[model samples]
Target: MSPEEKPGGPPPPPPQAGRCRGARPQQQQQQPRRGGLLSEIRTAIRSEPFHLRYRLSPGRELGRGKFAVVKKCIQKDTEKEFAAKFMRKRRKGQDCRMEIIHEIAVLELAQCNPWVINLHEVYETATEMILVLEYAAGGEIFDQCVAEREEAFKEKDVKRLMKQILEGVSFLHRNNVVHLDLKPQNILLTSKSPLGDIKIVDFGLSRIMKSSEELREIMGTPEYVAPEILSYDPISTATDMWSIGVLAYVMLTGISPFLGDDKQETFLNISQMNVSYSGEDFDLISESAVDFIKTLLVKKPEDRATAEECLQHPWLEQSDEPISRAWNESAGGESSDVTQQDADSASEKSVDAEKTEEDESIVTEELIVVASYTLGQCRQSEKEKATEQKAISKRFKFEEPLLQEIPGEFIY
Candidate 1:
């Protein structure tokens, strides 16, 4: 199922046809009989035709969304693999090409950041715009969250991934861009068996935050959204920090901090700041990890730690000795006076062996089953809530100013 659609959620409202307010006479005359407006919009955007440079693989869909579908594609000349994200030019009888264009522009601006996904090029057709993006073979980090206990990320692993995520967020904040959405699904890994570097993807909801203006919008996956978002308050970089806190909690415990039985309940939980760190959910988690989450999950946005601050938190700075020693104790291994560096190297070697064993034991079918169960348990409610949230967003009429023209530097 598409991320936008939940198993039991209501279908999206149908489109209501409408006419554009302004159009040049000559352009209207040149418009074709069908999909004319979209064609003109595509021309103005100036993208190369997708079919000319790349060939999409049949039955190789990467993902799907309300107005977009991602498929695996290969560049003809270089035979390089890429994920082609085809976004519809129009949605619900309104021109949404600009939103796709905005995402492209954000990607362009973030091209220099190693943590962010690289956009190779763009392509356009009458009805769709395609983004050629770097492909991450390891898939979503969400998978690891749902993996078996033995295969799930340990404290040390989560620290490494969280640091990278923070680095990416810091880079975006430095660029004055706020990635409103920052959940596990959007964070991809380059490799899976031994894990790999982070590649942050899905910038469709991201916005350029200007200091002179307060950007406020009710758009994000419900479970990971900040309290300010629920209150319809001004959004800041702290909003993303709130999500990072929730993400860290989920990564460590595989349980959402504020999720409830339903959308209304979820919102209420967030509004009231209802959360728990007791019981078996956090039994194996470290106090420093819990403290790290607490520091960011504060009700007040300003009180939350900034991305840079989060990088320097004690939880992230904790050396490998404690975790390694704990692991040794748990596994009934003998303790020795090993140096921190030696401990980390031993821990890495041990984790790698475990990973290899786990990879060999877990079959693809079991993974699919685990993934399906995890999605049903964790993401179904999130998807249902997200669909309703999108509908509620329409009532706000939160429109961003359309860009007059694509910047020359941003053009691919």
Candidate 2:
């Protein structure tokens, strides 16, 4: 398989392209003299006649997707490295220049935020646009998810990473933007050995939410998609929270909560809110972490925890100290001090249990809505099948008489 087609590995270096002649002095004018998609793109991105290769040295391909390939590039002047993403203006014979422009706009909107990947510059060619973006050398956090047991992240590490993710997401929500796609693959790290900070990338599926408008689209990775998305409900900031919940689950257990054998089954699992906290997968995990996941995985978008709330959760707010072992060691015998601490812990547990029960009740109520929605879908599918069957029957009946009218030898 080609390097671009290969999955889950460091991409090889991209081949060098031919250099073009420099733009004339008159053509170097910064004004958007041209009209159409180029003009629209110029409104958000600075377009220059000079080629990107003129100022930057292209290196290895960092990653590749459906319509874009990111390659490592170094600035000739500053010697700084950047990820240059090359995106096609057209996909499947359809003009999608506007979609690329929208992504540029979203990046520009969140440019000031440090957690989101920064866009350095943009260059346009005849058929493709190149975006020089801040390079995150650590690669995707997804690698850690599937890493060997010894290389997996501890609970405290998960807390730190989650906190940064929540901060970035909160910034986006505050700006009235929703990153429809929030998965491990889109999240990058600045360093790998010490585990650097999170840099959320890929705004290709993000959208700006307006109070006067309702945005709805069936987009995003199926494993991380929310119930509202499957139901065709209006999109909101809560949509991103659901993905965060799924992300947290994966980081904690290295397993997806609602994934099934196939896409249809996976969709059904998400639509029906089919998730579990089995002991096998979550036994070593803390209760606070489980509670945080439960809070955000609610089927009702309105009930899911927001980014701000998630940041404030006890799990994320826990101290960075080593995991405590006093409670576990006390299994043999308890001193007066340990006994008192146990009483206090039990009291806190009681309160937490009460809150958990309330949350469970709320989820139970939401399950009714989910069941109704699923039933309606099944009914619709049955109706469509019956209608198709009737059409086929009518056609067969009409054709049977025509066959009878023909000679037996001709029919044979």
Candidate 3:
């Protein structure tokens, strides 16, 4: 199911977002969420009335949400390409113009960072909202993470991703925007020239906080969510840093550190802040990098390093030099030449097909148990919220998910 097809809100289940494959099996048709950032901008664009800006030749559906759909659009006059994210103006008997305003405000505020997605133009109708945006061609980085490669990503690759994420997220923090949801699906990669560069996206669950305010909300996916969120306590910028730690762990090891067999267990692990790098997974990983993750994964948000402090960490600032070739070769390194040495059955891949089911983005078989548990929890929570609340709040709603947690694209 695509994010749009899901009832709870857009799930950020990133499709196999590599270059937007032209042919997709009917069962594999769910495309990436252009993740929720694309839909966020579209929802935001509907806030204002504008002249017919451009003719939209909708291509493949980039992302989906309850009320929005993002597609590749082209400028009628100049023939330039852009993402046209369409959204309904009203839903559940409520006028959502205010929602559009909020989305645009965040997009404009975060535009200064190159790693953030750009809102290009806006158009509106009585029933729909259309937003033109800078297209992200490479798609999400999830496919590679789940690939059969002996390694998910090298230390150098992880550093590259984390550095860009930290820099961009730092910018968001400086501006007071708290990205309540930070996960792979919400993170997209640029096309061609910059290839694998990271783009921090999906503002659906993000909030702009007052310097003195204590932001608190039951938002964010299970695995990547900060413990503070679990307790329904106040939130801070550190919430995002916690997610970064989870992201770093997954990127480097292709496995989630704190995930468990059920929501209760997953939440239990998070509450305990228990993580392991002692396994074979960390044997090849650097102590400095592990230390970096440990610093961010602390039980107390105050104990977690700030984004700026993370940038200063030796693992991120110094020579990446890549984790040893043996590690990369085992995990699946950048060098195609090395992949040839592997057994025929284990061809070097960006994602391990065996682990993921068709378009379902769960990264590894090891993750299925934990990931499925999170999904079950998210669904139950969604149902509970629906029946319990007079009206469901979009705050807890996923920006884009085909599943819950990580739409959470295997892990939010």
Top model by TM-score, which number?
Answer: 1
Candidate 3 off by > 4 Å: 1-59, 150-152, 192-194, 324-327, 330-412
lDDT of 3 by residue, 1-412 (tens): 2222222333222222111234332233321122223222222333444424455564556666566677776676788877776767676666765555556556655554677787776777778767677877766665445544432456787788888898778767765567877876667777533447887766656665554556556777777788998898888889999999988877776566676655566789889867777654566778898899988998888889998889889988788675642345445433333433443334345356642432242112111212212221111111223243322221112223223222221211
> RMSD (Cα, Å) of candidate 3?
14.7
lDDT of 2 by residue, 1-412 (tens): 2222223444221110001134112222121112111112223354765343434454555666656777777776677888888888877777767667766655655555667888778887788888888989998777666454445666778899998898788777765668877877788899999989989988766666666667667777777889998888998999999999999987776566776655676789888888887643464567888999999999999999988788889888878745422222235323334544555665576777775654343211001111101110001111123344322121100000001111000000
Top model number, lDDT? 1
Q: What TM value does model 3 have?
A: 0.68
Tens digits of per-residue lDDT for model 1 on 35-83? 1111222124436677788899888467656567778888899999888
* Ordered list by lDDT, greatest first: 1, 2, 3
Positional deviation of 25 in candidate 2, in angstroms? Answer: 26
Off by over 4 Å in 1: 1-48, 321-412
Minimum summed lDDT over a 10-residue window in model 3 is located at 373-382
Model 2 spans > 4 angstroms off: 1-60, 324-412
